[model samples]
Target chain A: MASRAAVKTVIMVAAVALAAATGLAGAGARAADADAVRRGEYLFNAAGCLGCHTDEKGGGKPLAGGRALATPFGTFYPPNITPDPEHGIGRWSDADFIRAFREGRAPDGSYLYPAFPYPSYTRMTDRDLLDLKAYLFSREPVAAANRPHDLSMPFSWRFLLAGWQWLYFDTRGPRPDDPAKPPEWNRGRYVVDALGHCGECHTPRTTFGGMEADRYLAGNPKGPNGDKVPNITPQPRFGIGGWTPGDITLLLETGLTPEGDVVGNAMAEVVRNSTSKLTADDRAAVAAYLQSLPPIGPPP
Target chain B: MDSRVVNALAAGSVAAFLYLGFGGLGAAATDGDPAALVKQREQTMKSMGGGLQTIAKFVKGEAGSAADVQAAVAAITEASSKDPAVVFPQGTAIGTADSDAKPELWQNWPKAVEYWNGLKPATAKLTEAANAGDRAQIAQALQGVSKACANCHEDFRQKKQ
Candidate 1:
């Protein structure tokens, strides 16, 4: 009886090993699909596409793109980015989508306004953009009509944006990282400069609505709606130089400042829909990158 | 303008200045000093903000004891219980240097008062949750408190540049 039991146990162990080997191969394929969607979702949130596109104030569908962005140039409405064939990106080939994201050119070859933030999105890697596309394609498509932007006179001419782009836009992706820098810092650089686009709000703009690269992350006095977006540089009095990485992580997670201030402006919306959903590791990366920025004084 | 008459007039002006500057006009000084009132209320608001941060630290499991949560909740409740009408005296609105309070706050005074009044129950719920050490309850109550603040600030508080 003991000999029979030992033989049966050996057979059971062999069968289990065989099943494990077979399952591992299938898991690899499944993991790729799952992983792409996950990464894309992260990019979507980090890029802040939904904040301007979605009509959250009107309880409209996500990415349907009806919210009006008030700018010095005019009020520009974001277009529907859902996968609907007629109304969204459903008809867009991968190349067309890439052109729009990287060059701010639509499938129809019209120049996209800078309000779409392609200047920052242009710095993203092709692989990351593809992953983001995969995630966007997986969403439910809404058939919302794209709204026309309300701009005055010459600003309404989309061709004028080409001149603006010539002055400010850099079509290249981020430069290769310094070999001496840690891999984590490089990763943080990619996330902060490209995907996160923190400088869009933090950096003051030039007279023609271009970023003032000299005072990067120094704060904008003429931010949207005439509100002063505080300087975030490490300046002692005006900037966040005093904030520790943990303090920043907490702010991203819970919208609570180290000084006990609850963010109530556009940042509150960002916290609710974007940064708060990011993983702790991603938040830490953001903190690391922000801390590395050159300390600059507030706008004069 | 005789010498004696001029001397009496100078003495009277000095007496009035001392009366107003010192504790002579006590009730009027307390209500009339808008800068002092604004400063006091701002300090109270800061204390409330600190309390919320402490509670959040506990909720995130970052650090802080249960006692700390209770203490924070107590501070919030104490700060929020003050009457908004008394705290926000007249002449504290827009154009006051360093004052972020908008004139719309005084225009829509009743609704403004309601926003502060709404915090009482929200903080009460927070106190109960903090004492019970229920993280979910505390988070929900915190959201309520945050909403109350946002609702008021959206209309009343001027955004700082």
Candidate 2:
């Protein structure tokens, strides 16, 4: 009887231990998911997702997407990106999310418009894209139907977008690190090129609306809403060459120019939504990357 | 010639003189010429910018004393205290040379007024900070002022073309 009782005690102890171990493993997984969500929130701000997705002027719900983006082609309303299964991306599989950014193809395999800035987002790594998706999914599942784009004729047809994508979209995978450059520079490059998508407005576009890569960051004469985007290259006269890295960081953080004037208009929205939310190190990284660019003179 | 005809000719000459002399002045007085109003507003804005720069210099310890900061804050306060309606009268929207004011300012007049009114508290905080001579508080208060400026400028000011 004593031996049987002792065996029963040993089995009970083993069962309790196994239960605790399983509990700890579950907790660890939850913590990792939480961490990914946090990282994704930061990436969302960096990518300026909220500004385009939320119609603050019209009192639209955040990420529910009724905001109208006026383009030369026509007005494009960004779709709902929240986690609602019916209207948002809640039903999207991980592969679907990755494909949207990587190939600019929807789950239905329809071509996304270039106005989505996928050209820049396509430079994001699969991991970063997934992290962003994780963050987006964590938001409240808002239930708002997406407003359709108001394009005319050929531009409205999704089939034409395939031709547009073929002409302009670079099929290159995530931007690789340069062995020669420091890690900080590479990180800066990622934030500026991949997440910020600054060139989508700052770079001049061709007649067909594809970005002019040769004149990168040279400033667009006719940007969104007919605003003239300024040159951000390191040119002494035309660009930000006179600005120090600290100046750039300060501008990103506060929208205050070195000359003591605060920036206004659309760039102010960028500063408020995106750059201001970046970590101090990331802001400095943006400055470093911008200052290192080859300065291009004004278009002739 | 008859005396009546001579009097009639004299009245006509006087009327022509008055029209030539005060016609432009009368029009300016009533509706505020768009060009002149834009030029005046731009100057006022530039002066405000200069005052902020002086305060910024003090905050950075690059130059200027507390007294300079006080004076700068006072100038900014004085300039910003004016009724925005007078400063931004109708017909002073963008398209006037060097005027960055967007037509939205007039279109959304009440919102613009609210944004302009928002500057009051920011300037007040700046004034208090300047008086206290606390560098940290002054810098923080200055940020509030910048934000106030940006709030209106974001919707009402056009970017450099």
Candidate 3:
């Protein structure tokens, strides 16, 4: 009886060992893909791709773009960015995807509208972009058809964006983090300026849709959909100057305000989808950086 | 009577008065006056806003009034617990002036109810945190309440007039 039990135990041990060895071999091959997808998921949220890419009215399918972004210029429907070969970016080369984000150029060599936010995204690092592409490619592809923009006359011309790009698009990537600042502050700056692109909506723009660098993050009076984006600068009267760092952090995480006012409209979407997903430390850093900004009044 | 007991009795009466003043608006809402209903909800929201600010002042150490904090939390709990459906019935969205409620609020009634429903838990948490007298917990709970308010307004409330 002892000899029979020993034989059974030996057989079970051998079977387990064989399964582990086989799994290890496959795990090594899949590990890199897994890492890239994880990194991509982080970048996708950080870059706020879902806000514009998803069709909000149609239940917001991930990356199956159809969100109509309204601007003073026109209402532009974001294209399908899913991995579907027919209706999405599946057939495009890595270079094509990179160029679209970095140079605002489509695979067919046509210029994209400024509404796509490539100008701000162009500041992202190459590695980040690559990881983002990997993440996007990993998503379940949906075959949603592309919708065209409703633009007035000349604005519909894709070639015209080239002239717009020449005026506003910076060839240089993001400016390096200030060495004088702490790593946390730098991270906050990177998230705000490069990843979150908070200035895109907060800062007032020039007549031709170029960001007015002088009025950076001071709150745009002529915001999207004609709503006034409130001043976020630390100005005591009009901006968030009176708020504590915790207040800002809470606002980012939960879209709540000291006045018991919840952040509304576009910012609500931002908190729900983008900034809320950030780590607590990262959100705190963002608050710290925002607090440190020179307190400026509303844009003239 | 013991002073603590007296204080409790006074607080309870004040709370009851405040509740009746605001809760009466809820009753007015059902009287078939959409305008009155809108006005009542707006007043309730304003009270919630005031309560939130009062607590924020305490959290920031701008105010050290324990009684104020207690009163604020009580008011917020009261205001938040009211069913937004009762306050924002059909046709309360009329008039192009003053009211910022969107017509889509009625069109998507179930979604509206969901938004209103989300408020209670946050306020309940706030009541616990405030009772505990922990500043950090209170601050966190305050955020919970604020987020709930902001989320609903984002979808249902119209742009400020």
Candidate 4:
């Protein structure tokens, strides 16, 4: 009779002390460091992970998977990245996470399907990957069950992914910024090239699924629903070269084109979930970065 | 005269003229070959599509409430496809908008039929929803019909900017 009540009190006090010590309760309100995590948080938001990883269940359960990404390649069921040790990335090592984010290689060295958009991810620098992990790990973990992907047989072979990576692997990381550019512009460039991975759909692909770097951001016919993902590079005719940086920022915030048409396919989802959540200044920064790229006209 | 009687008499006179009024002029005006027959049917549908657009604009403007929407939808339904030949011609699957419908629609006829037939049913639901005086139902029906239009367009019409 004495043991039961005493045990419960001790447990409750222990939990309270742990919560206060770890600062876990206030994680959402607090943006730690505004230094490293700030950069990582910016990278994550730009990458649009919250869009793809979370269907964002009622009241906004981030990283609880239900978002479906379809491309001509195949449907990729993005895994739950919540810090659940069993269903999410809680157990993933820094190396494993870096490999996945930077090289499109999974924790087990299997080539991650391109649906993960590793082509654009290959541009991420080592520092970028590390910071992203810190930001992600610091987040409050929501334990949601992972959904198994419904890929057909040829795609179901996870080991074959190794060979696919060997053919298309690009792990050199993003190129160093042109030294003449301002630091903010360089930061914006780093966000887009490595973490944002904008090219996975916008860039043209070779027969075997490698990015056609020269044709970067040119329109692609085989988009999420076969709706064209129009060129973002500054080609006046077919690309977004004509859009002012403000126009680009507006598109990110509202999913509406500068001309006021809404994006319908995969882009709409990105705008709805991730970009719309960014600060106006961040959206402008991303716009500025994209505007810097050379124009690549629509695919021939 | 009744409308039927007038139409019959007019048809007879036009035929008689085509037969005897001129030489190659009659044949040129009326294609006699099978290939040309299909083209004629599609041309007729296209010719009538303008009427649909005009009526659609009128109905869209008139629709501020549920009852008004029902009447508008009823008008649009008849315009969309009071007759089958308007939407699904034998030769082309260009749908309501274009004349040169592609062959893929017929190649994949079953799925294409699903898309084409859904238009009338969806439009009818819209009319019913409007009559029911439920703004939400009417909106749902409108969206449903629009989706059908997009589906058929994606399948049959050539991509244009």
Off by over 4 Å in 1: A1-34, B1-44, B53-68, B81-156
Local accuracy of candidate 4 as per-residue lDDT tens digits, A81-199? 87778778889998898778677776866667777777677777777777777778778887778777777667778787777777776667677887998766787676566656777
The CAPRI classification for model 2 reads as: acceptable
lDDT of each: 0.82, 0.88, 0.82, 0.65
Residue pairs in candidate 3 whose N, alpha carbon or C atoms collide under 3 angstroms: A262-B150, B100-B158
Tell me the DockQ of each model, to 2 decimals.
0.25, 0.39, 0.38, 0.04
Model 1 chain B: worst 10 consecutive residues (lDDT sum):
B23-32
Which tens-of-lDDT digit does each residue in A52-105 have in candidate 1?
889986798999886788888889888998999989999888888888878888
How high is the lDDT of residue B105 in model 4? 62
Better of 2 and 3 by DockQ: 2
Give the alpha carbon lDDT tens digit for every residue of B1-161 in model 4: 89999999999999988777675764775444445555664554343333233323333343244444555565566656634443454654444334445677667778767776777887778767767766556545554554555565544544334
Better lDDT candidate (3, 4):
3
Question: What DockQ does candidate 4 have relative to the true complex?
Answer: 0.04
**CAPRI class assigned to model 1:** acceptable
Candidate 3 lDDT score at position B123: 86
Highest DockQ among the candidates is held by which one?
2
All candidates in order of DockQ, best leading: 2, 3, 1, 4
**C-alpha lDDT of residue B56 in model 2:** 72
Question: TM-scores of the models, in the given order?
Answer: 0.76, 0.88, 0.81, 0.56
What's the true lDDT of residue A295 in model 2? Answer: 95
Residue A126 local lDDT, model 4: 74
